[model samples]
Target: MPLWLLLMLWRGSVAQVLSYKLKLQKSMTVQEGLCVHVPCEFSYPWLSFISAYVSWFQKGADVNQDPPVATNKPNQKLHERTQGRFFIRGDPQTGNCSLDITEVHMGDSGTYFFHLGTYSYLDTMFSLNVTALTHTPHIIIPGTLESGHPRNLTCSVPWACERSTPPIFSWTSAALTSLGPRTHLSSVLTLTPRPQDHGTNLTCQVYFPAAGVMVERTVQLNVTYAPQNTAIRIFQGSRTALGTLQNTSSVFILEGQALQLLCVTDSNPPAELSWFRGSPTWKATPICRSPILDVSQAGAVEEGDLICQAQNLLGSQHISLHLSVVYPLQLLSPSCSWEGEGLRCNCSSRAQRAPTLRWRLGEELLEGNHSNASWTVTSSLVGPWANSSLSLSGPLGSGLRLSCEAQNAQGKQSAAVLLLPDKPEPRTSGVIEAVAGAGTMALLSLCLCLIFRVKTGRKKTVQPVQSMDMSPAGSSGSGAYQHQSWTDIPAAPPAPAEARPISEEEQELHYALLRFPKPKYQEQEDIHTEYSEIKTHK
Candidate 1:
């Protein structure tokens, strides 16, 4: 043999010996109580020879002390430590050394080593990591579940891996005794819930083989729906009232006076309807049997409420109505008394409808016999601002009371005033007399001033010829006329001394210098009288 060929053969042997290797396919993590598969593969021709001899070992107290796990020939030293917790299934012929661990516990997590014994020698070791699966499924619940309504719930994994097996699902509730079908990942559990199943505790449990029985996931369920079982209640003012079966008795009146009752109740369904009254207990009663009840006029019923119920399959509801009875209008005693100088009174009536107003003196209607007396009637409707008034008047000294009566379909209201003679006040009459006397005096003064103006004009015409002579006779005549004219003017008594007759221009300047005096009634009256007289003369 050549030396180089021998070296080549030796190198090939070394390479084959050094090349055999095993490791986990990829990193993996698993929850406790779940199943995990630790992937493993090897490279070695001896794998086929000692396929059954392949053993798994975990790192021990020392670097050299690798403890053996399930294998064809287990060492007592290794078997005592890791028995029953791990199992291996693989084909050494194909160089596959993978492991499948079931019911994995927290203690099963650690580094693993695969070793093969062949030809009386242990080969180089292959390393792997065995991690316990440690996650559980999560459950979520939505707020409400109505009967015949679709519901959605979810279960999911907190952490997932491509190699990790998808979780399986099972549902349990007080209403359901057994688990249902398994659900898929990212899938919704949809169901139409019913009322009967409301308030039941629903649970979703997740299964992972590696994380054993004690670590399942679960969640609770809640549901809501409409109401049921409605009823009615009644009250009057503050006190509750009971239905009665009495007929025309004092409780019943010809005019109409009645009591009202109110009804109320609670339910999920809203209540509808107004106040209603009848003998619900007595089947034979007309009102009880009839769909509608006729209100009685003779026996006036008072205001009351009728309550009606609204209901669903789940619960009942209630509402109310107010009822008022109409009464006939009537006057009682027909007597009159004064109110603010007006007469008021009530008249008696037995008629079913309010009586129309007709004044009667000793049983005869006043319209025919009383030609002097006046009468008025006023009526109003139940609501505000609905009113009508009628009035009649007669001789002032007739010694009769004037009456005002208000009537409605239900009742009457009236007022009156006495027709007594009223004497006029002396002071008020005296003021009128003084005004007349002053007016007469003013007329006389106005007539005198008109006569004086005519006399002054005549004197001026006669004196103009005499003034051409510049004679004493002319001057004396002018002075006398001026004095008489000033006396007739009756203004400020000529200002104590005679004032020179001012020209029109001078008068204007004087007016400009003087403040205008405020007008007085007496001055205005005199002016008005003078103007009237001048108009009469024209």
Candidate 2:
């Protein structure tokens, strides 16, 4: 071991120590009252005997000023010499010289330097940029949000520069998300606005680096929408659906074909309303304006459903109504036809709505069993119609007037039929019944006499059709069979016709007033007609 060899090694070691490099971060970013880390690393000769200490110095705004801020010396706690805000996070023994700055303030914005010291010290400086955003976060909602439409809201945080670190943002609603980087640090909130969401509160929370303090801001959402209910009324017709319901439902009318319909609505922000046909295309070209709509315009078909729409900037609502244009019950003339022992009367007509039909004999409602009354609702290619019928037996009295009334919600109509040839005269006493019967019998006897007189010359011998009781005065008239259910008499049937020998002289017999011939027994049918038409004296 020569002294010269040791001196050479010593000089080499000194040169290696002098060549060691201290790496320092060029700049750091900080927010008011927040914490920041200064990056530092260094390389020195290994196994060296010099112990090293780490220190930090904050430079002034001026070019030539520097002041010590914090240090890590052996056996020294950070709180003994400096405030709790500043500390050393790295160990010089491990060549880590990183510094920590907590509770940073605006005045802490300056150039900073780091030093590694043993017997002497080696120092280098870096830039510190501090931004103060001590206020609350701001929320922005542009314009008005329309219900049922997609829209966006913004949570914005102001920064000192475009290059400044962006603040972390959180929203009370999970719908918040991030969009890359912009001039302002922001989080976007996307939503589809709804009418029920009006006046809802939305909050945006932001965590800033300056002081590590979180700020919250809230903004209310404004949503616009149209009417939710509508109703209609018709003049000269019943109110639709009974009251002011959203559905106009149905309206019935009679008489005139023309109609007036009024529409009423409830809405927010005052809706723009109009009348239309059944489809959405009708809205583009409305049939009319305002609340009133005229359905009967000349040849227009107003029988189908119509729509009323109320609209605003937000949305539109519609109400549906059926316009049933109906006319009064139209009863056609009823005709009576004889069917066996009974008579049938058939009445029919057209009506707008459902109709009820009834038959009345003067004041009493009349109905027959099988030959009875009937009513029906029938549908055609055009629309619906009703038909009805009534029947009566031969026992029905003569001069009975039958009336058929057809009625509906619109109105009523009627038709009548007369069962007799002429208007009947009333009878007062029971004796009048016998007198009237006698008069009828005498009139019929006169007709028979005229018929026999005409035939007397045709036949010389009496081809005795049958012999009648040459009885006199007034007793009774009987034949092989009596006609039953005749209208002239209430109970007695017409006498069966007979033919007998008649001398021409008997036709000339004249009396004050001829009495009714008495009914007499007959052995068999007459040789002449079985049935004969009766002729009455007017």
Candidate 3:
């Protein structure tokens, strides 16, 4: 072993080691069901070997017995796990050994080395880290979503390799959707949103068959819409809500009652609610700028329309209510009067609306123009007032009752009177009593005259005193007497009495005239006088 021989052997070994050099990426990361590219370059000492090939083999394996994971050599065998998914790019003659892998699985995660034909091998190796798929589907929305309008949406996985198996695509949403075009990388869907579909979720899910894994993406829908289903709810005072009116309606409210009206609508964006006094148009000013309209007095509300309008940026809607205020019934006093032999009675009543009138005979109720043997009834209507009259045609019964009744939708009223058959008429009874008393007084005056004549005859000779007769011109009857001033009358001397017995006719005609002094009491302002004359036959 001389120094010169040792030097020659060391130089040849150094040159061979420098020629078999490899430039490759040290490590690469790939997701399951995706592809990865490993760039590599190398230099070999065999420059005369044309039409050469390259292969890749898993590290820590026997290169002489085990097949390569990927190869470009003709008639060369490959590993079953990476036969179709792994390939070596570029020719070995150009010293380019780039490796490409599609649909990489967890089992493919290992270190691999480059092999140059059967005699050359690169010591430099690269590691592949195959992790679970974390790539989610991408959802692309081209434009804004409007309610009731159709639009297209796309979901795609652009990172996936073209050589990989096509993934299964599915969609989940609450909106109306239909299938559109589809490809190995992307799927298209036609979506029609509604007002109710606003703020809802839409999901695009994809299934990788090669790796048996699923990936998904979710997006919230923002749908714009106009007002719809506009309505008004009515509430009386503090009570619960009553009817709901979607369009025009008529409502009858009692006078002076409180009311509440609420307007409501459905839309994507919230709508503005307002209340109007009458039928509203687009330019009408609103009375209230809120959803609720409170009326303190129903009677004060005019007989017209009340409108509730709901408006938004997209469109508007409204509802109307016609208000009618009603009042209670009122009745006037009834009257009854005598019309010849029949009794007539009248009754009248008035109200906000026209009222009806009727009659009650004792316990029976009668209406319209009723005619019977005993009584008759007639009715008439004039504006708000209703009138009725009753006539009794036959003789009245003892303690009989008659009534006039008036009624309307609000209330009813009646007036009654009692009649007695035995009672006399007021004017005739007074006249009869006065005449009887006057007759009695005349008889008493005659008797007093006879007494006076007997006394005078016994005391003195029967002498006749000639007295001036002041009787009126009609003086043939004994009852006739002369009229003198009440203040200056003198006492009369007794006339001579006749000896013969008085005849019955003369006695009937006989009368006495008496004068009484004025009463001393200042309280008495009037005096009553009766005159009768005494007549004698000799």
Candidate 4:
């Protein structure tokens, strides 16, 4: 009796173990803060009219004491650890048992089993490996970034579950940016790119509060921009930088100097720099294709305007440099001629800048069109040329130098003429001495006549002696009487000679006669004026 009963029980237990059959995915891998779905189906012996419920529980947990992680029953309670994150999605009436887990954490890593009513299947289960979050946020750049243009950028965590707590999104960038729309797992950012923002890093960070994990992605921005901050640098030589010019400017340079100019600008893509001769347009061919422009001394004569241009694919910019070449003052040889009792001199000069003309007469600086007692100076300036006329009318000094000088900011120049001594006139001096001796004889005759008149008065002689006074004779012919009276007056004392004996050294005095030859181009009559300087030896 015992053998038959035990054989029946053993067969029944084996049949019950084989009847609870299930099919499901064996193992699944899910990152923390993400979701996973385990597809499962099971066939169990049950009545058709009775309603059945499906449930899921963590491995090594008591189904009766510890609550199930998921349940489809109306009044069944769930595990606090996975109450909202774990659920059984399929209907039990259709023999479908799919386990869905959202916001899976590291603590949820283990084996799980499915239960249908009072029956449980442990052989057909799935293992969830909840690894550390390794997924990064995705940065979506719709198109090319252009400077000064605003565009929307999207940062999303598409792999994260929507049922999980919304993640906090943040953006970090050096560009001008503002907040845009936000969804369950993504955030939008409105970005305005600038030239300076090129090649800069933009980071998108997502923080999952439930999992206490954060993920981020960084991308470098490529911004297209136009040429900006166009400027020209002036270099005096190869090594020295004089200054920087950002706008149009006028500059002056010495005649024999060289200049070096460099153009610079800011842009995303490299800009092309060029140098133009004058006010040329963009279509004109440039004098220099590089950024550096070298101006040699030979080209200084053609000074006017120079332009520097910086162009890029986006836009272009330029600056102008006005040039003025200055030269030193120059003076031509002075021309001199003799006018009526005066010496006339004309001087002409030219220079880049208007030069001042003046006359230099023996250490005296004479300027302007003013007149004095001895000399008159008249000057005129037109453009770069200057002309001056000097007239001297007075006692002339021998061995004197007269010079014409011109001066300006660049330099000064002068031209001079030397006056030479001339021989004295001996004939003109001898007649002056003879006239002095005749005047002395006349004075002595008058004194002798006065003395004779006094003696005649003392004698009381009534007879009038021939009047010895040599005076102008009346209407009568008394030419011979006047001669006799003059001879008789000489009986008075002979006048002593006041003249000194002349020595060889004192015989001749030096005189200078300055005579200027008139130019053939002049139409005025030739002047005969001459200046003579005479001096006696001491």
Candidate 5:
């Protein structure tokens, strides 16, 4: 052997190996109830010398048992489990071997290995791949309905195995023979549900030859709902009477008159009949063959609307009846001494027409009663309306119970009120007298102030003669008196003092001769003169 030759052969071997790699032409996936074909191709020049045996095996360590292969002679040991499920085809000249699988299941998902036999009598690994197949189909049903009406339901499988030849569909139920064509990949069943169908089980089954297995789903149906068409009827009057009709046709009645209200209704399964004056004030009564509600005449039955309702599984219906009652107009019953002075009472009548009112004390009708009473009347335009009242305040401490009676063409109604004496309010005369006395004192003080002002004014108007002189000390007091007397002399007569005319110098000397009392006294007099001068300046 030569080194160059050895290297060349190694190179040649590497190139050939790379060029002859195996390849699969087509890959396939099949549903659980279907079939698939995996086609493969490969090239190897040296292996062409001897016809290679084509073998296929699930990729596992125990491949010898489940080998999927093509051989001229059948291999009994390997054909045991895989006999019907797998088949293979190959062409020796082209070096191609492809395998087909039927009735694929979830367990069949794995790599498949292809092997080729060589002249050396050894099988060589050619190609490997993964095969995916669907598992068992799951069916689901969402809901069901019952009673009132029919409803449609749907049945569905998780996946469709379209590859199965002549896909099979079927349903099973005890209520019906096998549902053939109606069953599909996704089937819908519609029918009016009855109580009997509830809890019934339904099954949808599909079969496939390729898979050699059946896939099925089951569901239980539930049906439930309410009942229907409730109504009512009224009897006792000429208007559609159910029992004996009354002679008179009147919706109104006077106080103390006998009255009855009848209520009736028709229902399936016979509903319980109940009587109610107002809402929630219900009383259960025995239902007769001809169910009717009857109420006795009572003072409390003034204007009121009565409602009747029928109820069953299906639904409910309600109807209303209006009642009018009239009674005598009366003052409120005088409350007892313990009850207080608020004495009030009511009068009502169910007469068909408006009634007249009369109030009386004992047996005699009183004129004062009419004067003390206030009246209000109300009229309704619609079919049955009621008028009610609340009364307040009346005479107290009258031992008698005042009666008010009302009469109509049909009958008369009356209501009485008892009077209870109330303690009179305490007298406030002393307080009023105190307030008046205080006012008189204030007025007297004001009058005194006015009288003082008028006296002062009169004194100012009447000038009085000064008996004593307010003159300088040491000076002749008679001089001031004489000066005043001279000034007081009337203008019609000339004073004797003024007739004696004195020279200017003599007048000055005379003033000099008239000396002030003392230096301190003169100083004080000068200060007074200075002050007067300041006042004049200002």
Candidate 6:
């Protein structure tokens, strides 16, 4: 018992106190069905270090009254709570008294003590705690998570004991949540799920007080939703508009062309699509069953509507497309013929669609350009083709040119013809005109000769009447009343007179008289004369 020996003993005790970790992790969190390693190391005299002399103990919430539940020593049997779960495998020569636990179960969360038995037994100053994860966090979700609908998910972790500390819960989603602590701890997350949430995992983690790792669990949501915005589209045809068959735009199909329509939609599960023939109503006629609506022979008969319908277990939607056949104007026999003085033009064109046809004479396209011609006229369809006619009349010596143009949505084709009439040539026409003139002059000259001969005969008869009876109807007197119808004699008183002879210059030829137009005294003569005398003496 020297001073040096006393100092060495004091230093050894100090080393033991400085090197031993009296407290295991204040609390440890381990998962169920998993193994945990609790290591204990302390400074001890090299030769006296004994693994067989070590012992471990556990204390629950009521440490002062509750009996210990677990231990690793061999002198006493294992506690029922941790009987088959606890083991210590440190070598006998080593000072290590590390404990190995298998399939850690709940009810293991409590304070633990480590003791080393020597000449005098000593237990660690501070008690270590071993916590076994009561329950791994799990997620509970609803049957269906639809877009725009409110939803909630609960993450729960059971506590080992009523007095067990609350396990920290965390949610992967940044949603509003509420934490509840009871026999079990729960974190409820509230959110609205969208279609994008399909196949996404909602995760929850449970962390114990002293556990280095958190227990994580996930639930993959299988979101059930209706079909997205349904639209109609036409993948074929260069004439398609807005990727749809628009009522404003007539979808034209050529002869023998196929019309295909698609019902475009987006959904969780693929949507079932159908086709209808007309404007789809409550009582619409369904044509086929597919996203691709096929019109095998489009425009074979008449135009119709193609309604595309998309549906699922959720709902159905539709769109309509107008189908029509289109063709350019086809001109039939277009010709110009003579109709009396005017040249009549007739033309008929074949087309399935309506076409605007106009008539043009040379450069005149609007209507009539001259006073002699009439406006261009259009006629309704007589049969498969539209008939049009135009009458062009004018004083002309040459043929006129006319055209008929048929215009439609597809294109335009015009038919033209020259309007000519059968006529004599200009050179031959002059000869025929001269011959007609000569014949007319000869007939007039013959009539003039006949009139002259009749006048000569009439003058001879009038001369005899003038020489025989040149008497007045009422005469007072005359030098000699010879051959007078009525005459009177005048008395001469002792007077001798000589009369002069008439000169030839004073003579005049008698003019012919008309019997029908009588003189001015004809009205007076009618009273004195008989009806037979007033009549012509033909």
Top lDDT model: 4
Root-mean-square deviation of each candidate, in angstroms? 22.6, 16.2, 15.7, 17.6, 31.3, 25.5
For each candidate, give its TM-score against the true structure: 0.37, 0.41, 0.66, 0.68, 0.32, 0.49
Error of 3 at 52 (Å): 2.5
Error of 5 at 235 (Å): 24
Whole-model Cα lDDT per candidate? Answer: 0.43, 0.59, 0.76, 0.76, 0.45, 0.55
Ten contiguous residues with the weakest lDDT in model 2: 483-492
Residues 189-299, candidate 2, lDDT per residue (tens digit)? 776766666667777887656445567787776667677766776653443443444665776554455566777765557788788877656327877768888755412
Per-residue alpha-carbon lDDT of model 4 for 1-538, expressed as tens digits? 7999999999998887776889898999999988898898888775355567778988988988889999988777888889888888887787889988888889999999988767779877889998999999999999889998999999999989888899999999999999999999899999999999999999999999988889999999999999888998888866599889898897777778888888999986889999898877747999999999888782445588889888888988888998777766767777766787777888888877778999888989999989999999999887668999999987576766688788888778777765544322111112332453355455543332231223322333222233333323342342222322222211223222332333545332222222333322322244332222211112
Model 1 residue runs over 4 Å out of place are 46-51, 61-67, 73-82, 118-201, 204-226, 229-538
Q: For candidate 6, lDDT tens digit of each residue in 1-538?
A: 9999999999989886665444344445665544667766655455364555555556322333333334344556556766655666675346566676654555555566655543222344323344544456767776577776777777776433223445667777533334443334677777677777767777888765532446788777777777777777775565354365423345767756776677787777778877877666777667787777666665546466666777788776666666667655677545544566666666667766766667766677733222333544646664346677766666644555566788777788876553224331111112333454366456533322221112322322211011123233443343323342211112213212321232446322221211232212221332231111010000
Off by over 4 Å in 5: 23-43, 46-53, 58-78, 87-100, 105-112, 117-170, 174-178, 182-201, 207-215, 220-538
Rank by TM-score, descending? 4, 3, 6, 2, 1, 5
Ranking by lDDT: 4, 3, 2, 6, 5, 1
Q: How would you encode candidate 5's per-residue C-alpha lDDT over 1-538 as one tens digit per residue?
A: 9999999999998987665656674335555555667676767667657556666665553444454433433553454445666666667467766666655666666555665553211233323233444344454444536454645555555465333344466666644232212343555555565545657887766676555666776767665533223233334335454333222222544556544445444444345444444452335442332345554453554457555555555444455555556544332221112224443333333334455455555666632123335322222212221122223345543465465565556565555553323322111123332454467456543432221111322323222222323354345532232222111211233223212333334321100011133322222333211111000000
Residue-level lDDT tens digits of model 3 in 1-538: 9999999999988997888889988899999989998999888887556457778889877778898899887788889999888988776677788999988899999999988755445468899999999889999988889898999999999988888899999999999999899999999999999988899999999998987888999999999898889988889857688889887888877778788888888876889998888778778899999998887787744556888888888888888888776666777666666788887877788765678888778889889988898888889887557888888877776767676677777888766554534442211112332453367457644553352233322344443322434443434453444433221112434545544454555444322233543423322234343243333332
**Top of the candidates by TM-score:** 4
Instruction: Give me candidate 1's TM-score against the actual structure.
Output: 0.37
Clashes of each: 51, 13, 3, 0, 21, 0
Which candidate model has the greater lDDT, 4 or 6? 4
The TM-score, computed over Cα atoms with residue i paired to residue i, of candidate 2 is 0.41
Clashes counted in candidate 4 amount to 0
